[model samples]
Target: MKAKYLVLSFFFFTAGTLFSQNKSVPKSIIKQNASILKFYDKKELQSMQKGQLLVLYVERTKTLIKTLPYIALASKPGVTMVDLGIPFTSENISLLDTQHDATDKFLDITTEFQKGMLPYSDKESLIKAILFYESVLKQMHELNEQE
Candidate 1:
């Protein structure tokens, strides 16, 4: 009987904790839906004020983060395609090298995107392309925020 009572109390304690947590959201904020979120509309310069905006952005961007890994095409194995012969066997390459190439590709592709350098059916090419831009934004934000 005592063991049963203890178990029930523990369960209630855990349930209470979970309910309190769900009720009080410090980090996550919920918001209404947006009509459109396009390539150009992606730029959000305004400071976030409303809980709803935070929710929308978080949900949308969580989707984006989930999509990011899928967005990146596996780098083709070659010296010529990468063009610099940067030997990366995915073991010992430095991040600085990767950043340089990614940044260059970003600038190159932004021009290409405007001029239609790449064909249409590249399979999430645009998302991966924008990843570079987003990466830069994240880095800048982190740097400013001392992250």
Candidate 2:
């Protein structure tokens, strides 16, 4: 009899504690069905955002590429050019190196994307892609903002 009573008391105490721990959320903030999120689950929504950022990055890179001079392409094949004694300072060399690195990184990402190297499933590949895309997008945003 004592054991049964003790078990009942412990059950009631646990139930009461659990019930108290659950805080009530205000009804006003909770929508029955938000149309904006009607179709997309959290992962899909995140993937969509990453896709948008990639598109933006591609667009910006395209613009940048356009603005760059195509001097090498314009030059005739087997043509030897005389040195103009162009001065290359350390700072200028480093700046050009950094620019080339950024362009190469962007090209690498786009090439991988075009090859369908990133699997869009809710698996490890997709998660890693999402993180990579997010970081790239963040870097682009910061550079744009600075400019």
Candidate 3:
């Protein structure tokens, strides 16, 4: 009886330890974090080169924003990490859920100008888009200054 009790206790203790050690963050959060980091790469930000890099940045930003939902969904229970035997805490999952919603709002604001003035072929539309982007940059700069 004593030996059986010892074995049962040992099994329970090992299981508890394993379950408590699950600190894996969801893959969605990890993916977004990586893209955000790459989007803010120092070399790209610091480079003097203008037109090409600016276009590339805008495209990349749009793509990343579009991907947030899919990435966030990829971490559903029994989907990615859970299926692989890696576990994540509820706190981390909730944080990512909130962040993903915020990302949608950010994308809407960031693309407001483009969405308003789509199909920019004519000279006037082109000029308007340019002015819109300039205004956005000005506002962003002011916000940074305030911070």
Question: Which candidate achieves the best TM-score against the true structure?
Answer: 3
lDDT of 1 at 71: 18
Residue 63 deviation, candidate 2, in Å?
A: 17
Q: If both were scored by TM-score, which would come out higher, candidate 2 or candidate 3?
A: 3
The true-versus-predicted C-alpha distance at residue 111 of model 1, in Å, is: 3.6
Q: Per-prediction TM-score, please?
A: 0.22, 0.26, 0.30
Tens-digit per-residue lDDT, 1-147, candidate 2: 999999999999999988884322212111122111122233653556545534433443443342233232211112111122323445544554565567667667775674474234344444454445444434433542452
Question: Candidate 3 residues 4-87, lDDT tens each?
Answer: 999999999999988894545344433433222222333434443444444444555555454435432432212444544545
Give the candidate order by descending lDDT: 3, 2, 1
Q: How good is model 2 by TM-score? A: 0.26
| TM-score computed on alpha carbons, candidate 3 | 0.30
**Model 1, runs deviating above 4 Å:** 1-113
Q: Residue 123 CA error for candidate 1 (Å)?
A: 3.6
Task: Give the clashing pairs for model 1.
Answer: 31-52
Worst 10-residue lDDT window for candidate 1 reads: 26-35
Model 2 scores what on Cα lDDT? 0.42
